[model samples]
Target: PASTQRHVKSINKRASGQAFEVILKPLSPVSDAAHSLPSPPKRDISLDDIQKKLEAAEERRRSQEAQVLRALAEKREHERDVLMKAMEENSNFSKMAEEKLQLKMDQIKENRDAHLAAMIERLPNFHGPSTSLHPTPSFSPALTLSRADTRPWRPRGGGPHRHITPPHTIMLTTAISIISGYKHG
Candidate 1:
């Protein structure tokens, strides 16, 4: 019985020593490790530092804006150059067209003048009664033969005769007669 009691006491003391060792080992390592690690670096942030950073950011933004404005100005200048070039081309085309029109008008005027000169050259002068005539006095012409003569005469030549009967004149006379008859009716 004495030997049994001694064995139990020895077992209890071994268990207590193991528990104490487990607790003390973990605590000492944790505390020592915490103390050995360096503390985090101190940061003394000031309002001046924040203001300087903000100013730097603002300067960068301003520079970007300036670059954008310069690019826009260059683009506008290029566009203006293109527009001016197009305007110049249009003006040149217009000038060419005007010149062509003027040339055509000049050619038309020259042709008309030449035709008039030819017509004048072919026509006979009628200042006096010595010109050719048919000598027939019974035609009862509508226009006077001359300013001095009371007899009327018909044109004899074929070149644009002044006394030629117009087709419209017959139509006009018929229309007038019909209108007069309708009015009487």
Candidate 2:
């Protein structure tokens, strides 16, 4: 080929620093056997093959989607089961607590009732004599009071003659003093 003829070249180099010229050779009379060989025949693809491939791909996609959906469903079911179990446990715990509380209340009531019964049994030991509705001269002490002794008693330090300031007036006076001191200081 003309391209092969143009590429034919030879290079020579000497021990010295000088470089020889590149010499191109003439084209040889060689036959193009490699190019003359027959090429492989092109195989035709049928429409059925493409359709089968598309159906296979579609089936794979459907299978993958189904798997994902199944996994999601399983996860949801597991979560629901866990939630139900937790709720059941919580309810059971509450019921247990309520039962315990009721038991404690019953115990308290029983103890209280027992204590009341014991107190009632001991009541007669501390009971005093009950006096009759009418006063008897033999059982009562006689007293003779003059008219001057009938007046109500009064405290010695605080009487009608003593002058005392009201508590609110004292507090007000103290507050005024404190405010005046603060302003002067």
Candidate 3:
């Protein structure tokens, strides 16, 4: 051991005079231990450790993919629900509009009927001799048409074709025309 240990010489200088100094120092213990000790055995990586890490990474990837799929499904569901709600609202609006139109149409029909009845009730007020021009015409009015004196005629140069429509016929025609015109209008 003594032979294996290494030594070095040292020198010193004084201001008074230059002196020769003999000193022997052995090698430091840290240097000897560095050479004597073997490096720690290299850590061995097992196949199971690498496989476990890969499996964990794959699991994490699958989990992330699942989350993305779930989010997409939820988004589609929300969109579908919104579309259905809009459609329902549109349907309700259409129904309400149709009902309102129908109600207005019914009111118009009632008003037309009332006006027609009022016109029909006023027919008897027309002036006619023995032909009152009532809603229910009497046979006397028809007889008045054929009578010699009541026969309608317009003297045109005293010709044979001087016969014209009777007063009662004219009144009846006016009433009919009024009814037909009201209906059409």
Candidate 4:
């Protein structure tokens, strides 16, 4: 009965310890050691042939890189040319606008002078206004300063009214009352 108890205690100790056994074995696909070596290449292939193919591939890759760089440079150059052209056009347009304004001012002066001269000629005793306001047929320092007709506009250089003026200017009106001696109601 003691022997039977001892056998039960041994079985319990083994179950708690949990020891395991292992067995090494080769794979079924590679059972033969001789089959593991790789096969040799045919006699027709050589190191020179492989080297030539590698060099050709390298040359092709270099040519592709060069083409990409050339395309990028061309794109940059085209953009620069477009920007320069736009700036030139803007400068020309501004110059033309300034010339137009000067021409308009000169035209106004001409019309006012012609009208005033005609009205004053009709009167026997017509006194002219101050030289600063209007210029007469005679030459004066004030007339010379305001005169634009004598100095013609040159596109290359030496343009009339080079300075900027107000877009809206006050123009004098012809006063018929001064010439006719008539009173306003």
Q: Quick one: best TM-score, which candidate?
A: 3
Candidate 3 Cα lDDT to native: 0.69
Task: Evaluate all candidate structures by whole-model CA lDDT and list the values in order.
Answer: 0.56, 0.59, 0.69, 0.57
Summarize candidate 3's per-residue lDDT along 1-185 as a digit string, tens digits: 87466554556678877867565656777778888877799988899999999999999999999999999999999999999999999999999999999999999989977875765565544333232343234323453344564656676677677668765567655655666565455
Q: Where does candidate 4 have its weakest 10-residue lDDT segment?
A: 165-174
User: Candidate 3: TM-score?
Assistant: 0.51
Q: Candidate 1 on 5-98: residue-level lDDT in tens?
A: 3222222346456522222222345567877878899999999999999999999999999999999999999999999999999999999999
Q: How do all models score by TM-score?
A: 0.47, 0.47, 0.51, 0.39
Model 3, residue 138: distance off in Å is: 7.5
Give the clashing residue pairs of candidate 3, or none: none
Model 3, position 184: C-alpha lDDT score: 57
TM-score of 1: 0.47
lDDT of 4 by residue, 114-171 (tens): 8767655653323455334333433232232344533434445556656443221111
Global local distance difference test of model 2: 0.59
- The global Cα lDDT (0 to 1) of model 4 is 0.57
Error of 4 at 37 (Å): 22
Predicted candidate 2: what Cα RMSD to the true structure? 17.2
Instruction: Report lDDT (Cα) of residue 171, candidate 2.
Output: 43
